[model samples]
Target: MLDREPYADLPDLPRFDLTSEDVTDGGPLARAQLSGIMGAGGDDVSPQLSWSGAPEGTKSYVVTVFDPDAPTPSGFWHWCLSNIPAGVTSLERGAASDPPAGAVRHRNDGGTDEYIGAAPPPGHGTHRYIVCVTAVDVEELEVGPDDSPATVNFQLFFHGLGRALLTGTHEEQ
Candidate 1:
């Protein structure tokens, strides 16, 4: 297993609260959180997420799902949603299908503008999914819907005011 913390190189931003109803930190992902699109024999549903205690000046939020233990140098981005209204803190399960108004769903590594759940290769051991919420200083990032997750991350590096994260693990035979 790769010992990688995806955010290790990021600036030490203030931390906040992030919780999920369908995914538990350090626990195995539910079948709903696995990838049907990738033929993982499970529904590719995004988990329900909630957060609080963001920095005082936070104007918007960004949400991302990353797989750091992927078999590639750049890892993989499963989801990237940006420009979420600051007042909005919780996302209902399956919200990836219809993101909050004004929020932009950036392209994931799979080239889809929605959450594509875990589908690590069989026999690849376990993989960790880091679900993150970022409090941003600006109302909207410079990137557009066509932009990649890396682009959103780059903007986040500059305008992010706080961050919260939860992790879930999964594997196949």
Candidate 2:
């Protein structure tokens, strides 16, 4: 495993509010977001997300779904969406299956523009999915569709005005 900074240790500005009617923080993830692994039936749908209370100077938003407990040195990114209009504050469930207009879908850790959903390797234990909505200072991140999650994170880190997270957990049966 690779050594990396714990997410909480990162520099963060003031907090905002992010919520989801489909996902409960610290609660089980909805099956719709589960992956079809080990014969488990799943749709790999992104959960409905909503946010509010961004600080002044917010220009756009970035939304992502990351798995911190995956059996990986760098964790895993299930979603990496950039250039969401600042006027936009919510994403309907399954939106990842078909990205909304003006939403720039960046390459996730899975190397695709689609949400791969939760699919921990067998015996990998429970995993926490941290879904984040970042308020960015720029209306559009200077990035391409091929940009990796790490690249996007770097950009957001510096340009981020504030952020909010709606976390949920899941484990294989």
Candidate 3:
């Protein structure tokens, strides 16, 4: 069986937190003032991200947004990206969809290589978007650029050095 804990063999790395000015509790997303929406403003509004305390020997980073409570058995991927340089610490809003220089955007669950903002079913209550930034040991994985999110995650199993997670909630009326 595949190891469920990919990081089980790696040494413990420092942890970091991700926060945003455009995210808040029970407020209008527009007022949180983040960029990018599924059908709005080019759909490239990446969230602002900042982090600290990456582990030693980290060569690069990968960012992803996952929703475990989606109506599918495999959940959903809102965004997936890899090959972010270690020197970079933040991404402008919509940057996840329109990655910066040298980064690669993987296909989300919708089968498109972009960020699809939360639009949970009318009665699904609230859904959480788990945004994660993984510190990696390599600049790039063995997987190809056209790989799906599952493929990219498979590669991450071996090279992940550490990770940081941030969560935001959304609900549709």
* lDDT tens digits by residue: candidate 3, 22-112: 5543343442222245432323344677777888888888888776667776677878888888887788876865677888888887667
Badly placed stretches (over 4 Å) of model 2 are 1-6, 37-39
TM-score of 2: 0.92
Question: lDDT of each model, Cα atoms only?
Answer: 0.93, 0.82, 0.69
Predicted model with the maximum TM-score: 1
Model 2, position 7: C-alpha lDDT score: 61
Better of 1 and 2 by TM-score: 1
Q: Report the C-alpha lDDT of model 1 over 1-173, residue by residue, as the tens digit.
A: 57789898999999999999998999999999999999888788999999999999999999999999889998989999999999999999998989999999988888889899999999999999999999999998898999999999999999999999999999988
Index of the highest-lDDT prediction = 1
lDDT of 3 at 162: 78
Better of 2 and 3 by TM-score: 2
- Please give each candidate's TM-score: 0.98, 0.92, 0.79
Instruction: Spell out the clash pairs found in candidate 2.
Output: none
Q: After best superposition, candidate 2 residue 74: deviation in angstroms?
A: 0.3
lDDT of 2 by residue, 32-90 (tens): 88876324467788899989999899999888999888777789999999989989888
